[model samples]
Target: MTSESSPTIGLPAGDDVFPVLPLRDIVVFPHMIVPLFVGREKSIRALEEVMRADKQILLATQQNPSEDEPTPESIFTVGTLASVLQLLKLPDGTVKVLVEGVSRAEILRYTANENYYEAHARRIADNVGDQVEVEALARSVVAEFENYVKLNKKISPEVVGAVTQLDDYSKVADTVASHLAIKIPEKQAILALPTVVERLERVLGMMESEISVLQVEKRIRSRVKRQMEKTQREYYLNEQMKAIQKELGDSEDGKDELAELEEKINKTKLSKEAREKAQNELKKLRQMSPMSAEATVVRNYLDWLLGIPWGKKSKVRNDLNYAQEVLDADHFGLEKVKDRIVEYLAVQSRASKIRGPILCLVGPPGVGKTSLGKSIAKATGREFVRMSLGGVRDEAEIRGHRRTYIGSMPGKVIQSMRKAKKSNPLFLLDEIDKLGMDFRGDPSSALLEVLDPEQNQSFNDHYLEVDYDLSSVMFVTTANTLNIPPPLMDRMEIIRIAGYTEDEKSDTSRLYLVPNILMEHALEAKEFSVDDEALKTVIRRYTREAGVRNLERELATLARKSVKELILAKKKSIKVSPKNLEDFLG
Candidate 1:
């Protein structure tokens, strides 16, 4: 409930407000100043609101503002009450505003009236002392912060003098830490630190540690910056590529470069099987626009054809040790499912570095299916993504809605592929059995080419119109039942996800679930105890499901019912008992 620290020289008159722009990775304290360029209509309007309102605003960050409409979510309980100090309108129709943060405020979410952002907030109450008295720590922190500034990339050391004159120590420390020219997640971690002291300590530690290994740090920074710049350049180039592709009209059926290649291969004296394979590749390529990323991927893919030793494989051992270790580390039980996956990997090791068969795990709800998929990804060192097909009936859901449809997409498969940013991923198609067919189209039938290994190597999604090699993708599907289409089911190796046995549930209760339940309720385990018999009774009498669905609900309910009584007993300086379960359960 304390206020955020500010950065401007003098305290903000106890009332002058500032607009807190809550970006994903930036955290500014009450006494900290954040500079933002306002160009987008939404951001411009934000600045206009502050300027029109005399620079008073709740500058809070949000995950998604547009979706919630008008109200951009206020991230943390603590945020700066910033005020507009200076405003400049640029010739390019952009506004530059310098806002002064006054105090910290606790925002209770947001409520919007118009197209801008608004929130209900109360001032944060930080009782930390001023910086002048803590000279040693301040000197050490500031000095370390100066070094942090120097070591970082894209940041000039000249900014240090201005930083030292910064009013709030915490704000200064966090600001330097924020703009440390570090990774987004690293910056986010610094911003998310609760106390200025903690932030200073954490940042100083990283700075001191990294500075000692200065060469390594510099090398890493240089490499990362180069990679990032390269990626941005490539992304822009790709956009331009798309525009050019659009300028070129459609390729007539069987008349593109790929089609001609197919004709040549067909006329050659190749075997029927070889001819068919090359023909499929050509057809897929012809369908793909040359300038598209998919076409680029396909073109590059043809290079492998000249080189792959036909059946050469890697040295992945069939031993169950690594897989077992990973599975046991992340999950409690489901040994059968784990064993099957390990076996699949073992069998796949014999193949020429191609994908293992797609696995669709079918089980009742809440049997840790999704988590298991993640663990498998971790085990195989592959990225993981989940695409739910529960209510999608359109063929476009599996393939993609054609771009001609106005708001077109490159299919869930393509999106997932993009998300992983890799050719190979442990793609989890969740709730496959739940996928339904309605007026749009049967999405499951469309998934046929995607899941079918025979055709998925050249999977031609409708929107992409390009045959993407889904063959490299180690796809996994999860279903609550075995009622999935036989064609779809046939393509996958099914792993039955059974409910946790009572003993397994007991282990989870003691190990993972109960501790989390206590932490969430903001209570210690010592506040209350459940007898082994009571736990058994709760599991058997109150809940009956193959999954831990009801078990989670019951634990939550038990914690809620006991919390008030536990608090009352604590106030009285006494103990509470298991008999208290009745009030909660009832």
Candidate 2:
């Protein structure tokens, strides 16, 4: 409807009374046309009253859109006077009305009406303050509104052409404000402004802010679109390359490698749990790119899994006499240790399936504790592997680090087993008492699972993520003192290796140390000789130790001096005696 026709039909002969319509979410500005869906009873009544009489309604925004029936205080004082152009009553008991805003109006008072809300209000004329300032703001707001329409695809471009053609600045400001996607309170504040310059300025500021936000949103959309396209392009190229390689028969190497691993997985005698885990990891490896880092980690895990001696075992020497002979030939005077080892061999010979005993040899430093482990391995004919637990503090050092960690691997236990190359090896854990605890974890606690006969049959490594059989492997631990943790101490049978007696040390020097020192010095037994009294004097005077380690050092020194004496004196033989022992030794 035209502006002149709407004002003439709304109020006749200075009557300010009009039907009041409370809008829920919109603030209607003058010169703006909008469609309203009237659902509330009072709203439908107000629309019907205006359609029947003057087709005029005072449209005010509700303070709270959630309010079903708004009181006078809930409605804004200033509103737009709108003329109803068309009204359609639907079967759902709602009226759809098309209304054209005519002018701004101020509510004077509410009139008593039984059917619907009626309000006495007067039209509010626009105040044009300083034509120059109003003209400047209108131009800036129009420019910004055009930019907003371009950035925001929701607004029609035709609206910008319609706004620029309007000669009245007040109408231009109201037209721009109506099209803006701003909140109700902000639009209401713009409608409440009396001066055209003030309304245009407020609209300009809001348009600029909206334009800035839209520009940022546009940039983000462009960036995300580019990233998605790049990812899709790379994926397509990789798939095409794979297809080309397959057609040319160039992908057979990778296929052959995977097939070989699959064959190994089938042939190698892995336990039930371990075989299942290997198959699952291999499936994942097949799906992943060969060049990817994650694929390498999975491949390394499979290598470790396949590298373990699953069913391979060395033949355990069953002869007790041979074991005793080997033990006696290696060590001098540890009769008790040798006897225990021979007993173990004897029992293993008779039993069908025997789990190796966990032996902890407690002794002083340099008392042949470490050497005894080697001797036992030799006598039993099992592969020997030694892992020192002197300063091991991380539990990972024993149980292995998880595969999630970078550069992670199986713990010392699993690593040693891999090196042993046999399922049943003599695994010696040296310095068991020196196992340390820290924040990473307690190595001693981790060893509990390794030493327990009941639990160690299915020893689990973190990186391997599979159970390994340790039932056949013999574990020997040596410590300087019995200062081991009680839990660890409980798992193994303790064998105390006491210091050697004076006589035992003398015999050990005469028999073991002297021969080894002569062989090392390149001197034969005929050329260099030490009498029993001279050896006793050297042991009693020069060295004072519980073990034969110091006596060995003293004997080595005498061998070196004997070599020097034979070279200078041109003598065929050099005899070290107690009479001239200080002359040679000092």
Candidate 3:
């Protein structure tokens, strides 16, 4: 092979033995020249040995580039026999050298060397076939490569000139293949081909693929350039209009809104840490344009900051007698439940900082499990909000969806506080036993933190991403059965409200249900009176249930039936007796 700037060197003869220098991420083909920077000690030693001896090295590529010192087996068996054309030592303790591939060689065996690897290799000459076919393949490869160079201008123009000048079919194939932008594996495949025809065919296929990729990349770059130009034009136009408006004293630019928000943030009583966070976010919002995406996110963040109650707490009434009176007035025949609530109130009165227990009311339907939450809220003079958690399946429903998800908002616990407009309010999570589970997540498990008074003080909603104080909030849960999970049940103090007896129902009907139903039906109380015997008859024969719900319905029916008589015949006073009750009831 002819050399440039250095003396020409011929191919090795007989069983040629040469020092092996492994390459990474590059393949060297016969008639192709390349420069390598040797950094590894073993590779540097191998290069120095080649320059001192025959100035010829077995330049092969390693399978893995990361291997600092590769064994003989880790390198490709078929490689280039290259001559050291020129050598230069750099200041970084490394040597750089130019080499030209002489011929294809196959390693027979690795020789034992202390510093680096040495292998005995045999030269493999190209088996040239019919001259006409080889010329045709070389011409096809050159045509495709020229087209590739046009699409991708990063390749040097000199490579195309050198390829066009070569007439030897084998040399033209190797020259174009080495310059193509392909990976080492594909290049190695071409180097391993025995005939010039095979190498030319493989190089043509690879260049076609590279050309297709370059066209796609060109289209993407063009699209990006157009978008950038459009954005630049719009930006300049907006800047000019803003300047003109400002010169005419006609620019508001959200100044009044920004000033008003700033005043509210300073005047509002927020925690020191929360106040500082809001100020930093507000500064970012002030710096951004209203049309920018970040401006909306910053505005939402500030809204949450200013909207929360922060340090505001509802007033708690801890009077035990008043609380008992409230319980008895709102509900009937729940003495045990009332006693537990009064005891909690008494404890709260003694210690101002004591947290309320998570009280779960277990009973049948219409037994006032939900109403008890309202009575407790009224008795304590705090706001009341009830969240029916019947078929809740996702934990996110309770703890809130993260803000990253679209349409995400605060959870039921946080939403209740916002609805009540207080940090501490009465939260009734009704129908706890009816909670469901699905692939989304288990919601009952999320109640673990909310029910625990200690952890609830720092309950962090995924959407809020802030610790909301819930220690002072009274959480009263209700369920019809004890089907709740063990971990969740362990957190609350379960109170059982058994069904009322026959006599208890009779008296409740007289004191609360009868009077309330009479007023609801718009019947005058003084005109019609339902006797105890008639009420007992209705309980025994007409309706049967654990609670006073059916008994109340029967009384409403009686009031409506008597109202018909009062409206039609002007009958003012009518007493319902057990003997004549069926006539009115039926």
Q: Report the number of the highest-lDDT candidate.
A: 2
**Candidate 2's residue-wise lDDT over 17-135, tens digit each?**
99999999999998788999999888888887877787689999999999997899999998999989889999999989999999888898998896788899988777776666777
The local lDDT score (0 to 100) that residue 189 gets in candidate 1 is 63
Q: Model 3: per-residue lDDT, tens digit, 19-44?
A: 88899988998877788998888888
Q: What TM-score does each of the candidates earn?
A: 0.45, 0.55, 0.54
Per lDDT, what order, best first? 2, 3, 1
C-alpha local distance difference test of each model: 0.66, 0.86, 0.82
- The digit string of per-residue lDDT tens for model 1 on 315-432 reads 3334467778988877778888888878887777577645556788888887889988898777777778889988888888778766456555567887777667556777888898
**Best candidate, TM-score-wise?**
2
What C-alpha lDDT does candidate 1 achieve relative to the native structure? 0.66
Show model 1 residue runs off by greater than 4 Å.
1-319, 354-356, 566-578
Model 1 RMSD, rounded to 1 decimal: 37.6
RMSD of 2: 17.7
